[model samples]
Each structure stands twice: as C-alpha cells, then as structure tokens.
Target: MSIDQVIEQVQAVYGSWGRETTVAQMRADWDRLFGETVSPDSSQPVDADGVCAAWIDAPEIDRDRVLLYFHGGGFQVGSVRSHFDLMHRLSAAARCRVLAVDYRLAPEHIFPAALDDALSAYAWLLEQGVPATNIALAGDSAGGGLALSLLLQLREAGMALPASAAVMSAWTDMTASGESYQTRADSDPIHQRRMVLAMAGNYLGQQDASDPRVSPLFAELQGLPPLLLQVGDRETVLDDSRMFAHKAQAAGVAVQLQVYDAMIHVFQQFPQHLTQAQEAIAAVGQHLEAHWPPHSNPYNS
Candidate 1:
C-alpha cells in the first residue's frame, strides 16, 4: 500500500497532534482515540516501583512459556491499552500468557527511567518463577528498541536471556544517523525528521544520545538471543533495523530482517485494513510459535 493511503487511514482513527502538546496530553488523546479497553482481559497490577500497568492472558492449560510485550509511542505516548490488540494476538499465536508492560514515557522520566522500568518488569517476571528459556520478548517502535536494550542489559547483568525476540520497525538509533533518515524521510507517513528531533530532544535531555541503552545499534551485539525484525520499506527508521541486523549477524547473533515494500512505519497497526499489515503480524506469530517451546495445552489447538 502507498504511504499516503496508510497515513489517511490512520489519521481517520487517530487525529493529528500539535507540536506544542505535552506528553501527558498526547497520551490522553491516544487513549481516547484507541479507546481505553483495547485489551479484553483485565490487567493485574505487577508490584514494582515504576509499574504503570500490566495484563496477563493464560492458556486454558498452562504452559511454562510467556511473552513480555512493550508498546511503542516514541517513548512519549502509548499505553497498555494502546497495544492491547497486538498483545492479545501475540498471546494467542504463541499459545502462552503475555505480560504487557506500560513503562514510563520519556520527556517525563527520560533515559534510564524507561529502561529501568522495563528491566524491573522483567525481573518481576523472573521472580514469579517464569524460566528465562520459556519467555520471549517483543515490541514495536520505541518499545522494540527497548526490547533490544533490555536484552543487552540482561547480558551485561549476567542474567539468562529470553528464548527469542521480535521487533517491529524498531527505532534503534537515537542518533538518527541512518541513511534512511534522509532517503526515506519524505516517504514515511508517521515519522518525519522534525517529529523525530522533537522526540529525541525530549528523551535525551542532558544525557548523551550515544548511550548504548538509548541506541542499541551502537552496543555490543554478541551473545544476544535470536532476533526477528519486521520493518517497512519506506520507514525513516528502516536503516536502524537494517544496520542493527547487519551488526548482529557479524557479531554471530541469529537475526532475520523482513522488509515490507512500500509500507509505512509500524504497518502492523492496521491489520484489519491492510493486507501487508496482516501478513506482517502473521509472520511474527509464526516466528514466535516456532521458537517458543512446545505447549501441552489443548487450548492452544
């Protein structure tokens, strides 16, 4: 699909935002547009200092497996509700429960704050006795970046890593040094240089943008778990995923990069309306199912 058509459809569902709006206000507007109850299952509060929200979907018969989902909003917007549909779909596909984290947004919390919350959420899951081998990590956009960042941190902390990870149009490079930043900027529907610059300024504040956690592409990529990256051909962050995939492969990490031609940023958002989006989501589901351990639960059937 053309980028223009995708943007038009998204705009119909999510109205335009002004540059002057605060992060809190933007989040409220997103909640109103996407509706507050995107997740059909009720959320259970996870006991953590930065816990914003969390939801669990258990299989009819329990499996040791689980998926930790992080939503994307440039680290400024999005909530557990914003990504509820995608989480439910992933949970059903993986045939295991999913724990979606509502991590703190940037501009308000800044660097390390979001990362700390994500790490805390994962640590809580570990405390619950979910084995690392049975767990998978997944996210879109900034959250996708966060998934990679979390993996790197976990490795540094000498913790066992998840079985696998799936990232959708991840913004891995906060430095915005990717060639696509210029080449695909005009074609990308949702993201532009101006908006990206604004988001970076808010998130980075006084911190260095080159911090590995802020830009996973710049981090040491060795010893990470297998990674599945889904990106749109026209996304401004296209090179972010591309470069990360290249470096990861060179560092001996099993990595797969799937690029949808002529698509916009995070096309997975319109699964019902766009053929490519549905295909992308289904592809991710298949990858998760294949990598996740076999489930004895009849509910998975």
Candidate 2:
C-alpha cells in the first residue's frame, strides 16, 4: 500500500487528537474502539503479582510453548486489554498459549518500574514451570524495546533466556538521534516527533536516556536470543530497528529484519480493516513458530 493510502485509512479511523486528553482517556477510547472486535473468551483473570494482567489461550493441539506479550502505548498508555486482538490472533496462529503482561506505565511509575514489572512477570512465568526454551517474548513499540531490554537483563543476571523474540515497530532509542527522526518525521501517520519527545520526557524523568534498559539498541547485544524485528518503512523511529538489527547481526546474534513498505507504526492495530496489518501479524506468528517450535514443549517432560 502507498503511504498516502495508509495514512488516509488511519486518519479515517482516528481523527485529530485532543491535546488535553490524558492517558486514561486514550485507554477508554481504545477500549470502545476495539471492544467488539476482540474476543473476550481468551481473557484470564489477573495474576496476584499486582503488576501484570495476564490471559492464557489454549490451542487445539496443545503446543506447550508460551508467548509472553507486552503491549505498547509509548510507556504511558496501553494495557493487556488494548492488545487483546493481536494476542488472540497470535495465539491461534502459533497454536500456543499467550500470557499478556500489563506492566506499569510511565509518568506515574517512571523508568525501571515498568522494567521491574516486566522482569517480575517473566520470573513468575518461570516459577510456573514454563521452560525458557518454550517461551518467546513479543511486543510492539515501547513494549518491543522492553522485550529486548528484558532479554539483555536476563543474560546479565545469568538467567535462562526465551528461545527467541519478535518485536514490531520498536522505539529502542530514547535519544531519538536516528536519521529517520528527521527524514520521516512528517510522513509518519500515528506518531509525531514532538509527541515522541514528550513521551520520552515522561518516561525518563530525571534519568539518563543513555541507560541501556531505557534504550536497548545501545546496550550490549551479545548472548541474546535470536530476534525478529518488524518495522514500518515510514516510521520516524525506523532507524531504531535498523540500528538494532545491524548491531545485533554484527554481534553474531541471529536476526531477521522485515521492513514493510509504506506502513506506519504498529500497523497491526488495523488488522480488521487493513490487509497489510493482518499480513504483518501473520509474519510475526510465523517467525515465532519457526524459532520456538511446538515440539520443544517442555511441559511434556
């Protein structure tokens, strides 16, 4: 699809934003928009950690591999509910269950708190007997950055890592120095440079943007699991994925980078209305199935 066509479709669905809106209002709007499109049957009750809201969907063939998902909203919005449809489709396609984490957001919790919640959820999964080999971490936007950051943290802590990870439109660089920031700043549909800067300010209050967890693309990349990155060609943060993939490959990590032409940030949000979005999510499911095969189910042991 051409960039203009994509933008028109997105703008049709989501009109001009209200500058005075809060994250809570955005969350409510998202709920109203996607409530009927998503199947509620897949939802599970929240876990006791008080840091995450999780859901488990059992596949027909019993693939023991689990996908631990983190939703994206620039670290200030989004929840497990916001990503229910994507998670459901992924779970069905991979023939495995998915555990969506509702990590704490920023501007309220700030840096490290979201990271801490993500790590805690992963630890909880491990404690539940989900083998590292049978697990795959996935997310989009800020959540995508978090997934990679979590993998880095796990490696540093000498913990078992997930078999692989799939990240889409990841905002891996808080410094936002990428060439795309200037080149694609005006072309992207959903995100604006000013908005990104504001979100970054909220996420990194009084903290260094250079911190590895806050910016995974700048972190040490060795010893991390195989990774699959799906990025839109028009996103301002396109260079974030580009640089991360380049560095990871140079560091000897297996990486697949799929750059979709003329797409915008997190295109999967329109799976119901856009063929491209459906295709993108299918690609993600395929990548997960390839790296974390159902036969590797540790539950059978």
Candidate 3:
C-alpha cells in the first residue's frame, strides 16, 4: 500500500475516536491498528520493580546493550503489545535487546505516574547491573517526550545517564505552541491543534501545561546526552523535533535532526509499507551505534 492509503487507514481509525469513545475502546482500537501480529516467542515479559515491561530480542542481537523503549499514545493509550513489532524492528536495527515499558496511561495514572514508572524501570535496569553506558533511550511521540523527560530527571537527580537517546516525532511541547500545528494542519491527516491540546489536558490534569517535567520543550536541556531526532515534514508537531533540536544544540549538546520528506507523525511505525520508514529505523541504529562506548562492538559478540 502507498503512504496515502496508510494515512487514510490511520485517519479512519483515529476518526472513530469520537466524543463517545470510551478510553477502553480507544485503547483497543489503537492496539488493533498497530498491535503485534507475529508469534510472541521472541519477547519475554518482566516486572521492572512495579512497572510492567517486556524484553524483546532480535534473532541475532548483542546482549550487552539495550534499548529502553516507551510507546506513544499521547500518554493516554498504547501498550507494549501495541508497540511490540516496532520495538522488535528496533532491536534488529540497533542489534541489541529492547526493554519495552508498558507505562501507565493518563486520566487514570496521570502526569508524574508515567514519568515515575519510567524512572522505576531505568532504576531497575541499573539495579540489575546494566551499566548506564550500555543503555540507550528511545520512544515515539508522547513516549519520545517521556524518554527525554526521564533523561532530564536523571540529570537533575545526579544519576548516571544513558549513552544516548533517539526520539521520533516527539511531542515535546504540551502547550501546543509549535508553529507546525497550523502550517502543517492541512497535510497532517490524524492530528490537529485541538486534539493535541485535549490529549495534553487529559494527561496533565490540573498540572501546569508548561511544566518542564511534562513538557520537555520548556525545560533547561543542558548536560543531556547525544540525541537523534526524527520527524516527518508533514507532521503537525514537526516543530516539536525542530525546536527541541535547536534547544539541545544551543545547550552545547550533540543533536542530529532528520526531517523525512512527505512523511507524517511517527512514520517509522509503518515500516512494512514505507521505505523511508525503514531508512529512518536504520538511521536510529547507526545513531545508537555511533554513540556507544568505542570498545563495545556488538557485532563481535
């Protein structure tokens, strides 16, 4: 199928999320649309402290390194199941294991709950003796923002940092302040300004929308690790990646930003039908490998 067809299907799924749609129904729809379809043998479930998660291994992988992943659902929907295929692809591309965290969602768990669970999983990884230098952080959309938020949290607490981080179409600004929201509105099939604000409000509850812990775009980004940010030029949140990359660079951090022409939000999620998606995932792998400790070559294992 072509990218247009994929966009139509996505719009169909998202359009069904009407005012009457229950959170449960939305969750199910999201899973049905993007959930795993292959055999479950490659993935093993685990409890990272109290946070539910799973470990996914590529057919051939470097056990020494890991990609700690978060799934995107505007912080209200999505699960490890929904994102298993993507995580598995990432494992293969990055040539490492992936610990996919099924973090709690909003209107039920709310703001800091998801962030807290992320911290818990990372801390659990550390407790298990996985050196921070052997780990990398990754996620898409809201989860992408969460990964960055976790990085900031770790830095502020003086905890060890991961080797690097990569985010795709990250929703870094919860305030819906990005100019792309308007400029790219006609081209983006699934998202708009109001929907963006609605998702943020549901996740934020009564919390301030501009809070850096939730909206990493507003945060002080000094001391963060090397970053690989990918966004579709057609995404309504395109500026989320652009603005965050600018800020990170200004903070004296190494940042690589790739804007895929004619792509949409989290386009990598549709790799099965999109060539650019495949190339983007491979780029993520290259970014991770380039930033890893020099002596740690996964292929030699």
TM-scores for all predictions: 0.91, 0.91, 0.97
Worst window of 10 by summed lDDT in candidate 1:
33-42
lDDT winner: 3
Which of the two candidates, 2 or 3, achieves a greater lDDT against the reference? 3
Q: Which parts of model 3 have CA positions greater than 4 angstroms off?
A: 294-301
**What clash count does candidate 1 reach?**
0
TM-score of 1: 0.91
Against the true structure, whose TM-score is highest?
3
Query: What are the lDDT scores of the predictions, listed in order?
Result: 0.82, 0.83, 0.92
Q: After superposition, how far is residue 50 of candidate 2 from its true place, in Å?
A: 3.3
Indicate the residue-level lDDT of 283 in model 2.
85
List the pairs of residues colliding in candidate 1: none
What is the alpha-carbon lDDT of model 3 when measured against the actual structure?
Answer: 0.92
What is the per-residue lDDT of model 3 for residues 65-89, given as tens digits with 9 covering 90 to 100?
9899999999989988888888989
Q: Residue 67, candidate 2: how far off, in angstroms?
A: 0.3
Task: Residues 128-191, candidate 1: write the lDDT tens digits.
Answer: 8888888889999999999999999999999989999999999898888888989997787668
The residue ranges of model 1 lying beyond 4 angstroms of the native Cα positions read 1-4, 12-15, 36-42, 48-50, 58-63, 296-301
